[model samples]
Target: MASTLYKWAGLLFLSSFPYIFTLRGDFVFDDTEAIVKNKDVSSESWTDCFYNDFWGTNIKSNLSHKSYRPFTILTFRLNYIMNNRQLSALSFKTTNLFCHILSTVLVWFTYKIVVNIQHLKKHKIDISYFGALLFAVHPIHIEAISGIVGRADLLCGTTFFLAFICYDKAINSQKHSSLFMVVTIILSAVSMLFKENGVTVLGFCLFYDMIHNIKNKKETQIYKFCNKINMKRITILMLSIVFLLYGRWAIMGGTKPEFKATDNPAAFADSFTKVVTHSYIHFLNSLLFVWPQWLCYDWSMGCVPLIQKFLDHRILCPLLMYLYGIFIIRAIFCKQNKKFTKRILLLSVALIILPFLPAANIFYPVGFVIAERVLYIPSAGYCLMISFGLNKIITRFNKYKLGLIAYIILLLIYGLRSWQRSYDWQSEYQLFVNGMLVCPLNAKIHYNIAKVSDARNKTDVALASYKEAIRLYPEYYQAMNNLANLLKNQKKYQDAEYYLRSALKYKQDYPAVWMNLGIVLASTKRLKESEQAYKIALQYRKNYPDCYYNIGNLYLEMKKSENALDNWLKAINFNRKHELAWTNMIALLDNTEQLDRALQLIPNALSELPNSPLINFAVGNIYGKMDRFEEAEKHFLKAISLFDRKVQAIHYANLGVLYHRWKRYDMAEIMYKNALKINPDFKTAIRNLISLQKYKNR
Candidate 1:
């Protein structure tokens, strides 16, 4: 018992020690859309997870990514609430680490059940412990453990193992067989809810039952494989899987997720090319398991070019991999091997193949060409295979100590690699920079670099990277849209308009591009064209608050105050915490001498966005209009404090005007000079200062 406890402790420490650095890592790559910006994960209405896709878009919407993982989103929501309604990377990452550790423990338990069922007691080495240790330290899991958004796979893997364990119990315990079967069904469903491929656990259970039956019969014939199998239990399991699949189909509105060629280039290739490239991709995935030396966050956007010809060098790897698979299968059924060995090999292969089938692009196209996170569950099978192989080597050569030393060396290498890879995920910049090192030809990597650079206000680097991304993938509309946004910010209207148009040519239905085009058009004085673009954007995305806000800006440019106010109100209706829309609506009302109406709206806006500097500034202006001097002064001070980085000159100028109105000439003069310090040109402060001097003389 003490030895068992020590082994578990060792497994726990091995699982967690390499990933300790992940606690300091920030959300990177898809983590931004899936956690930081995802409304479903942060919203108070937790039920929204049921109706929205994983990234918080409505599940039925065409724009949705269609990854319906409500249970995973719920966990993210819980993480958000636990962190005081904030998106704390540490909290999310801590949960990821905990899930990964839980999965590692579950892998140990599940492997123990497999070992016991196969009756491998004659072996000197603890194969279950060895497999669990390999799984705990394998470097392939870095993406799933280090990236905060990979919680889906982590959670799914945990439940998958639990479901399999329950199925094993059902097979062995006649007294509680029915009860265990029910629990297995529930766990399987929960697994699928966490991640789509998790439904494959049921398949694993079915395969296990067949193998167990075959082992009992000691039969090698295919006809006798199901001779002694319990049909009733199999029927129940099959029915449950069908029902769960139907439920998933109904939830997704019976529509397959649409993907562009860039997402899975091989999926869109010619039949011959698709076959060869997909086979090569399988080889690449296997290679990653064998030697995880070159890892990248994304393996899409031309990372693996299509194998167009039969003689392509990449084709050789898949052929070799297939030959090895055949050899393993032959060895599994070989008469010389013990029945326990055959069971282990068959189960290990089932684990590797079944969980991976969903992502193999054989059934349907996935959004990514290759995702390391998707390999999390499949790696369990891989670790078991490696452990079994090593055991065989040690026994055949009669060199236990040498085998142990070699195993320790392998663990050290993988653990060190994992620790180093965790550092790569510490920041988006580091992650993408390392991805660039791995696959410099990948356009998505360059695009992500541009995005992070743009966020940091490194405009030149952003522009260059964006251009490179577009050059690498001509049909990359997202890169073009982002480049246009940067160009628009630089007041290069013509260049911005050119890229926006080019982007529209590729993705006409993209609302963000349309909205950006509207802004660029309005900048170039094409007001009518800008309005049409905003309407098109709104047409594509009915609930786009940013599109509505831009439309309001266009109406203001057209001097249509009522239209502007109405559109801003619509923006606020769609997103109650939209600071720009709220501030603009209040400002327009105050400008039109609707101080009472503006004051009425302030409380609700403040409730939703109490920390918004723009909302506070707008409220201060309204209070000043109402002659509430003390309240106005308080709000202005709060806005200044909230602005943090650099208080806008307009805010100080407006406060100066409030002081001027209150007849505090000295304070008003000081405020004007402060505003002038921020912006040397300072038209508003310059005019206000001269007027203040005249008032002082009076």
Candidate 2:
């Protein structure tokens, strides 16, 4: 027990040492979806925590990513809470580190229990320790452990390991107790909340127990003990699997559409040959365990070629892995004499294969052809294979010194590589730049870099990357859409129109593409085509608020006041927190002298978006117009208190208007000057100050 503790302590330190560089890491890629932009993770109320989908609010059309991972998302919410409701990469990365450490420790604990239960011999070599070390330094797991968004894999892995350990305890415990069994059942169910891959924990446990049952005779106490409880265990395991299937199927409805072709290789495989090709490539990628180097963040489309021949060179290694897996299966269920070596091999394969079953596109699309993070749980098998298989060969020659030296050298190389990779993960820009070097032809990497550049207002870099993305994959509608948006922002309406048309040529059904096309058309004064485009967007997607909002602007420009108000109100109904819709609707209400209705809507809008100073400011102006001085004063003060930028000069200017109405000309003058002080170039403040001078002269 003391030695086990010492080993785990050392392994924990070893596993975490290289990741210290990631302490300063920024959230990248899916972190944008999973944490930074996921409103559920940043919500103050627990109702939002439980009720919201994985992507947070469903205001935007994200059917492709309709996920129910409340448990995993809660972890992200906890990090948000710790960071004071602000999205901080440090807080998320810290939680990831914590999960990694816990998982590493659990790996050691679970491996020991499995070996002990299997009645495997404990010699000078502890296979479990070696397995744990190999797992720790395996560079394939870098994406899962180092990337903050990959916490789904980490949380799933941690829960799966605990469930496995609990299963072993339940089956092997001398006292007849279903307590451990019940815990195993609950843990298995809980694991799925973290990730869908987690459901395989039941299979891993049941299969391991089945193999152990084969090894132990009926007369043995171990076999007899389990025989009595095994039926109960099986029942519980079956129930868990049933619940998982029902939840995913019933809750999510059915298979999600692939919004992007690269989301799932198998799903995107429009032909049988394509499916076989992608399947083989996926298997070969995982076979990287045998040669654990040349790790990549993203593999370009067509990088993995089709397996045309029966015995193709590209798929040879993958074929061998399949044959070995067969051998391991044969060894486990062979009725005659079962070898301990074969049992270990089978168990190792179980560790690797079971967790990956969910990602087998045969089940459904899992939103990636191959991601290194999904290999985190499966990499445990690689560790076990090395410990049990390679360790035996080394000990046979009694070359402990040689094996030790080789192990140290290999870990040093891997550790250094991992350290270098950690730096790539330390910044969002660095990851994309590194991804660019590793897979320059990867359209998604370039697209992601372009998005980050657009966010930072680096228009040239964004344009270049977006163009490169389009160059690599001409059918990339997202790149086309984004590039058009950039061009639209620059008032390159012709270029914007061309790109939006190109995007429509590829993905005509995509409402956002149509919406952008409408805006570009409107900017170019093609009012008829613009209206058609907006109507087409609304026709394709009924709940499109952006289309409604844009059409409102078009109507307002055409002096169709009633139509404009109707469209803006529809936009607000679709997305109550939409600032433009709120602004437009309240403006129309104020213009029509429906001040009471505007005041009533402010509370509902406030409820939807508590922190929106614009809503408060708008309400304040309405109250001032209604002659409710106290209420107007309160809201104006609230808006001013929340102001964090010189761009908020309008709020102070509104205060000037309020004070002027209240017959405090001197106070109004002070407010106008303060507004001018904040933003010297603010024309509204300049006009307000001119009005103040007129009042003073009078």
Candidate 3:
């Protein structure tokens, strides 16, 4: 027990070293939208944070969209609260290091369980420790462990490993089989909450069981395979029913919401041909974890080929085909190997290949087929096979000398790669910049880097980057919209209008681009054109508060008071805390002498944004207009105290007037002087000072 504890501690300490240097990293690409800038989780209402409509909501939208991974959500929330409303990038990042350590421990435990499995035919493949070491230090896992929010991937992976171990325990009849089953189900559910791929655990477990059955049975082999086929069919039926029920809740409940082929990979000779080609590519990527030269977060869209060109060069496909044929023949004829050994080989292949089928570009081609995270579950099989292989090789050789040398070299290489890769994941910006260096023409890399630049106010650089992204992949609509935004910033109204139109052309229903285009038109004095853009935007996204807010502003500028009021009301209805709409409504009410209604709204605005300088300033102005001099003075003083001096000059001058009215001449003098200190040419302060001197003489 002590030795096991020491191993766990030792692994965690080694895993955590790279994180010490990564703490000060900035928020990466999705982290901005999902965590830092997402206001829903920022709100006091946790339920609202989870249930928020995914459409226009910021980080809160991440919950309901893309499989609603609540584990990631909970992680972010915990960090947010622990940081005491001032979450530094470091504080958020530390969590990922701890999660990675946890995942590594799980990986160790998983290997140990697989090694101890009674069905294993291989004798003492002592390389299990080396395989675990390789997995622990593999560079491919950097993407899952380095990014602060990527704890989701590690969380999913950790639970996935645990669930697999639980299945093995249940299969071995560890006396708590039913308890293990329940634990497996719950962990698998949590895995889904971490990522959509978590749903594959159940399928993988069944495949493992089937492989075992296939290997063990000789007399009943045909009947067993046939019965299992029917069982697979029934399982599919049951899962379909469950998905339909979940779909009803998901589809209606959404609060928000490639072609490849090297020379006919499909038209290849047969199923053998397709599987060989796909598996070759899959195995190559899986192999990269051992010897990762080119690391990338995304290999999608541009430059990179569908499959590595080397597979064809080496005639690997034919060789793999030959091996597969031999395996089939052995299953049929050769009765030499132990059942356990055969089962291990069969199950290992099944685990590695089965989970990947859904994403293997057969039924549908997901842009790029290669990714490290996609290998998360599949890597287990590879690690096990390697460990077993090691155990076999060591028994026939000098166990200590050769084994130690080989292990050291492999660990050194993988560990060095992992350490270097971890630096790239320090922040989204670093990741993208490094990824581009690795795969320069990857459009997503350029797009993501451009997004980070745009957020940091590096608009010119961002524009060029976005254009380059568009040049690389013209169909990238998100880049098109971002490029339009940059064009708008340059005040190239017509140019901005053209790019916005192009974005709409590519994907006509992109409401954010429509809203942006409307903003450009409104600024250029094209109110009618702007209104049309906003209406079209609203048609596509009825609850888009930003569109409603922009449309309201357009109506206000065009002197359509009633229409402006209607749209502002709609904006406020969509986002209750939309400060602009609230402020606008209060101003409109004050202008039209609806003082009582306007007065009532001050409290509402205050409730929305407590201690807000803008709200306080607005309240002060309202109170001054109503001739509530002392009340106005108090609020104006508060506003001036809270707000920046440059912006709160009017409030200071107003306070001077209130003091002068109450016969507080000495205090009025000080207030007027302070106002002039803020703005030298302050007309209000000048006039108020003259009035204060006259009042003193009287």
The local distance difference test score of each candidate is 0.90, 0.78, 0.69
On TM-score, who's better, 1 or 3? Answer: 1
TM-score of 2: 0.79
The true-versus-predicted C-alpha distance at residue 68 of model 3, in Å, is 6.2
The TM-scores, one per candidate, come to 0.90, 0.79, 0.75
What is every candidate's alpha-carbon RMSD to the true fold? 3.3, 5.4, 6.6
RMSD of 3: 6.6
Per-residue CA lDDT of candidate 1, range 1-698, in tens? 99978997998999999988888978788898988888888767879999989998888888877899999999988888988898999998999999999999999999898888766567757888999999999989999988887999999999999999999999989799989999999999999999998999999999898878776664555544454447777888789889999999889899888888888999999999998999999998999998999999999988988899988888899999999999998998799998888888889989999999989999888888889989999999999988988889999999999999989999999999999988898999999999999889899999999999988989999999999999999989999999999999999999999999999998889999999999999998999999999999999999999999999999998999989989999998998888999989888988899887887899999999999889899999999988899999999989999997779889899999999999888888989998998997989899989988986789
**Could you give candidate 2's per-residue lDDT for residues 361-423 as a string of tens digits?**
665666665678888898887777777765776767888778777777877777777777887
Poorest 10 consecutive residues of model 2 by lDDT? 57-66
lDDT, ranked from best to worst: 1, 2, 3
Once superposed on the true structure, which residue ranges of model 3 sit more than 4 Å away at CA? 1-6, 19-27, 31-99, 116-126, 146-156, 170-284, 303-348, 363-369, 388-399, 589-597, 645-698
TM-score of 3: 0.75
lDDT of 3 by residue, 1-698 (tens): 99767766667666676445666677765567767776654667665444443221432343333335556766677778888967677877778777777777777777666555453454543445556666677667666665555676778778877888887776557478667766776777777667656766777777666654554467565645457543653365347436633743473354332133321333233565445555666555655645688888776665343333444553464466558648755863558755655555665666566656645756544435466666665666666666666665676674856766776687677777777777777777778888898778777788888998898898877988899998877777788888877888788888888888888888888899889999999989988888888988999998998788888889888888888888988888889888878878877887888889888788878888766666666777778788887777777767676776445566677777777776778988998898888888999899878877886789
Per-residue error (Å), model 1, residue 333: 3.4
Question: Candidate 1 — which residues are off by over 4 angstroms?
Answer: 44-48, 57-66, 218-229, 539-548, 551-563, 585-611, 618-628, 676-698
Highest lDDT against the true fold, candidate:
1
